[model samples]
Target: MLTIIGLLSTTFGVSVASALMPLISVELFAVGLVLKAPHIPWWALAIVIATGQIGGKLLHYYAARGSIRLPRFMQRKKAAERKGRVREWLDAFRANCRKRPAWTGVVMLVSALASLPPFAAVAIIAGWAKVPVTTFLVTGFVGRFVRFGALAIAPGIVSTWV
Candidate 1:
C-alpha cells in the first residue's frame, strides 16, 4: 500500500498516473479484502486515494506557482521560451475561476476523469484562480470517493475477467 501511495505521488510526471490507477486500485482492493487487516480498512484506502488528490494538487500548485530561471548549463531552448503562453493561459484560467468559483470543483472532478497531461496545469490554474483550498479539498474528496468506490467494487464484478 505504501508502494502504491509512492507511485501515486510520483504520477505527476505524466499520463502514467492515470494508467497506473486501475492496476493499483484492483490490487489494493483485493489485498485489503483478502488479508482483512484491522489497521487498513477499506474506507482508509478510500481516504488515501482521496487525500492523494489533494497532495497531487499541492505538488502541481508549487510547480506552477513559480517561473524558474534555469542555469546556463542545464537550460533547454524550450524552457527559455513560451513565457507569454504560460502567462496568458494562467491569466485566462484565473478569469474563468472568478466568473464561476463553483466550477473549480467541476474542473477538479473532470481532471480526474480526463487524466490530462501534466495535471499540475489544471491544479495550478485552480489555485491561481483563487478557488478556496477548502473547496478544492471537498471537491477532491467527492471525486476520489466516486473513483475509489468504483474501483473497490469493480473487482467483484470483473472477477471472471481477471
Candidate 2:
C-alpha cells in the first residue's frame, strides 16, 4: 500500500511537470512507468496522471484569461498585441466561440487526445476564449483519461504478442 501511494504521488508530480513544461514528455514517462511497474493498474495510473495534467493546465487557462498575472519577464509586450492576422483570427475565434460555446469544448477534447493543436496551446486558448470551467474540466478529463489509459496499457498488449 505504501508503494502504491508513493508511485501514485510520483506519477502525479511528473504528469503536472509535463503539462507545465512541454519539453518533458509524459507519454514516454507513462510507457516506461508501466513497463517498470506492471502491477500498477492502467486505470489508476490514468486517473492520477489525468488529474495532475488538468490541475497544471488550469494555471495556464487562468493566466490566459487574465485571472492570473504572470511575472514581468514572462508577460507579453504591448507591441506583440499589435493588430495582425493572428490577432484578428483570435478575435474572430473568440467571437465564434461565444456564439457556439460547444465548439470550444470540442476543440479542447480533440486537442487533449490527438494533440494536433498542442494541448498546452489549447489550454491557453480555451482560457482566453473564456471557456467555462465545467466544460474544460469535463472534456479535458475525459480525453486525457482515454489517452493515458491506452498508453498505460500498450506495454501489456505488446508483451502478449511478443
Candidate 3:
C-alpha cells in the first residue's frame, strides 16, 4: 500500500514536471523498473504509473485549454504576423480533426504510445483542439501503461537472457 502510494506520487510528480521540463516521464518509467525488481509487480506498477501519468496530463491539458482562451495582445508587426501564422496552422489542424477524426485519433494513439512528438505536446494539442476528455484519458492511459509495462519488464527479460 505504501509502495503504491509512493509510486503514484512519484509518477504523478514526474509526469507533471515533464509537462514543463520534458523527458522526465521516460525516466520515471525507468525508475519503475528499479522499483519493480524488489517490491511491486510489474503489471501493478504499470497501472499505477499510467494512472498517475494520465492524472498529471489532465492538468497540462486543462492548463493549455485555459491558456488557449486567453486574449492575445500583439503590439509588434512581427508578433502579429506570427499570430496569423499560428491561427492558420490551428485552423488547418482543426479542419483535419473534423474531416478525418479516425486519422486524428490514430495519430493521437500512436503518438501517445510511442512518445513521438512528445506526450506533453500531444496533450497540449489535444487541449487546443478541444478533444473529448474521455478520448484523452483512455488513449493516454493505454499508451502510458504499455510503455511503462515494457520498461518494468525489461530488466527481468535481460537478466533471464544473460
Judge candidate 1 at residue 71 and give its lDDT: 54
TM-score of 3: 0.76
Question: Which candidate do you rate higher for lDDT, 2 or 3?
Answer: 2
Error of 3 at 83 (Å): 5.2
Report the C-alpha lDDT of model 1 over 43-160, residue by residue, as the tens digit.
Answer: 5555555566556566555444344343577443454465888768856767877788767677777665444523345666655466766766676667665666565555555665
Residue range 16-135, candidate 2, lDDT tens digits: 999999889889999988988899999999999999999999999999888999999877656365678978887788899888977778988999887878889999988988889898
Off by over 4 Å in 2: 77-81, 84-86
The residue-by-residue lDDT of candidate 3 on 1-162, one tens digit each, is 456567656655665566456646545555654656446677876777677678777877776666434335522233256666777887788788778867767777877788896787898888767787787888888888888788778777887899
Selected candidate, larger TM-score, 2 vs 3 = 2
**Could you estimate the TM-score for every candidate?**
0.55, 0.91, 0.76
The superposed Cα distance between candidate 3 and the true structure at residue 137, in angstroms, equals 0.8
Query: What ranges in model 3 sit over 4 Å off?
Result: 1-12, 23-29, 32-36, 67-85
| By lDDT: ranked, best first | 2, 3, 1
Best prediction by TM-score: 2
